[model samples]
Target: SLANAEKSQLEKELEAEKEEVETLRDNLRNRDKMMKDRIAMEESNRQEAERRMGGMSKKQMQSMEERAKSAEEEVEKSRKLVAEMRMAYTVALVQSRFLRKAMEKLNLITGVTKTENQSLSLRLSNAQKDLNKMEEETLNLKEELAKTKEKVAEAEEKVTHMKELVETMEEGIEER
Candidate 1:
């Protein structure tokens, strides 16, 4: 019974760990995609800004210059964000790797559990077969006991009949 309960608990724990690992993997995948997309988008925006920098009036050019400066600053900020995102991605990857390892461990435990369950099932089957055999033997013993009782009863009756016959014969002989 302890083994049965322990097996059940282990199964539940393994399932929860599996779900956790899947969630972590999904997060890692999403973060990787998001980082790549952000980097590509930032590069495209920078190129477009550079091309537009060519067409402008003197006054408008001054404003354009200021805008360009701001854009550069924005780009710098975006670069930093990308760096941070990359770091975050790396961290996520490391965590995902760890989670994968944990999942592997869980898989190993499940394998052990599978074997244990198989063994327990085999043992139970053997025990059931033994029990069946014992029940059959008990039935045979009961039948044999009943037959022995019948034979004993029959033998006792025959002995009584012989005794009565002997007494009757002796009386007849004495009377003569």
Candidate 2:
């Protein structure tokens, strides 16, 4: 019963962990999509800036460069965030796998132990029955032994009385 309870608890926890992992995976996928979109937008903006550079005034060009630099920095930041999220997701996945394996092993061990315990219990019961039977046989043998001793004692007493009578008869005949 304890093993079953533990197995149920482990299964519940494993289910929760799997759900959490799925949620993390979804979040990671969303972040990846966003990162890809931002990268594409930044590339498009860079191409537009290049096209406008031909007739642009000095100040305009400077402003465009600054804006492009800012966008690049933002893209870089987004890349870093994506990378971090991926790492987190990977870690969560690894943890979930480890927990699953551990739970499986625990279940296996519990099953084996339950089987062994049942077998041992059965063997103990059989041994107890055998001991009871042997005890009963011992009691019967003791009673029979007592009866045989009584008969042997009676036979010995009769033989002793007969020997005494024979001796007395011999003496009386010799005296006559």
Candidate 3:
């Protein structure tokens, strides 16, 4: 029963861990998709700026360059965030695997312990039964011993009565 309880608890924890891993994976995928979309949008903006720069005034061109620089910085930041997310995903995956393996090992150990506990319980039950039988036999032997003592006392009384009768007969013969 203890083993079953422990196994069930472990299974629940494993399930929770699996759910966490799945959630993390979903989050990572969503972030990756968003990052890709942003990169594509930045690329399109750069192309449009290039097209405008050809016929634009000096100040307009300078403004476009600044916007382009700002876009590059945003893209770099997105890349860094994606890299961090990937790293976090990898760590979560490794940790999930480790927890699964540990849980499996714990389940195995619990099974073995349950088996051993059952075996010991059976052995203890059998030993108790044997002890009860021995005690009963001892009680029977004690009763038999008491009966034998009574019989011995009766035999001794008969032997004394016979000795007195022999003495009385001898005394009567001497008087004759």
Candidate 4:
């Protein structure tokens, strides 16, 4: 019974582990998607900023250049963030693959255990049948034994009656 409980616990643990791994994968995908969206938004903003700088005077142009430099720095930061997101996605992919392999191994082990349990159950059923058959045969043999004992007792009684008859016949001959 303890072993059965342990097996059930292990199955629940495996299912929970699988669900956790899937949740991690989904979170990683969502983060990567959000990072890409942010990068795209930053690129669009940089383009719009450049278009605004196109119609400015000299002083305005210098100020625009400064602003453009800042935008470039921000864009660079966004790029770094994207790169980190990519790396994280890669790591999550690898981890997901590892988890899937582990799940497969667990499934294989569970299958083998089920097969073995079925085999043992069949063996036990066969043994029980054999035992039942032997018990029936023993009952039959006991009945036969009782009948043989009765027959032996009858034969012994017949032998005793024959002895008495023989003695009476001999005694009568002696009297004559």
Candidate 5:
């Protein structure tokens, strides 16, 4: 009688714990789905914003400006969602790691572990390279703009000098 009662109580506790795990799994799944959708939408919006940043007609600029603002807002939302998801994922991963450690202690099989360390490292290296390229591009654009401005100022100075010479010649003729 005592052994059967203990077994029933243990089964009830196990069932409750299983339900809790399932709930957390469901939450993690939903968060992941939302994160993926938001990232995809934001990627498109970001591309549009980048295109708008390039040269355009005045009217086109005005339209792009309005769209850019809206897209920026969307990107902000996406960033926030991504941040929340990253936090959630970190927490979940930590929990899973703890559970795996516990299972190891209890002599149970461990869940799958990441085996793509090299792949991850390579991707990060590539991302760094892309960042460097963008930085160089921005620097080149700034230098070009500075040179163009200097040329415009030089042209303006030349025009002013010509106007002064014309006035001086006209005054000499008047005096003669």
Candidate 6:
């Protein structure tokens, strides 16, 4: 049950990570396409302005040039943003790989720890059994010791009675 819980949690995390990676990739691709389209549109607008400028006044020409310069600046900014986004995507990819590897190692460690715990549990059970057996043996030994003590007490009583009879016989012999 512990293994299953851990595995499911890890799976959820991995799935979430994969989703994040996919989202980043999609965003990068969309941004790249938008940048390309913006650049192409800017180029088309510049060409159209040049074609119209042939009959335009000096001030109008200067305004047209300023607008083109502004558009170019916007394109440059977009390119830089795309570059930064690409770098972020790369970093995310690397982080995902590392996380996957870490998860795998964690799984392995968890499995090993579970096996070790089971082994320790078995050993503890065996030790308990051995302790119970030893306790039983101790109880039997105590019972035998008690019985031997009682026998010794009975033998001592008999020896005392025999000694008294011998003393009486010697007294009788002296009197005679």
Give the lDDT of residue 53 in candidate 3. 36
lDDT of 3 by residue, 139-161 (tens): 44334334433433443343344
The per-residue C-alpha lDDT of model 2 at residue 125 equals 51
Residues 10-58 of candidate 5 have per-residue lDDT tens digits of 3354344445444544554464455445445544644554455344345
lDDT computed for candidate 4: 0.46
TM-score, one value per model: 0.35, 0.48, 0.47, 0.37, 0.33, 0.49
lDDT of predicted model 2: 0.50
Over 1-176, each residue of candidate 4 has an lDDT whose tens digit, in order, gives 54444444544544454454445445544544554454455446445544653344456444434544554454455445445534544544454445444444434454346776675456445544544443444344334434433433443343344344434444544555
TM-score of 5: 0.33
TM-score of 4: 0.37
The full ranking of all candidates by TM-score, starting with the best, is 6, 2, 3, 4, 1, 5
Model 3 clashes, total count: 0
Q: Which portions of model 3 miss their true places by more than 4 Å?
A: 111-176
| lDDT tens digits by residue: candidate 6, 82-162 | 455545545555554554555556455654567865754464455445434433433443343344334334433433433
Which 10 consecutive positions of candidate 5 have the poorest summed lDDT?
A: 103-112
lDDT at 154 for candidate 6? Answer: 42
Question: Model 3, residue 137: what's the lDDT?
Answer: 39
Which of 3 and 5 is the better model by TM-score?
3
Candidate 4 C-alpha error for residue 164, in Å: 99
Off by over 4 Å in 2: 108-176
Indicate whether candidate 1 or candidate 4 has the larger TM-score.
Answer: 4
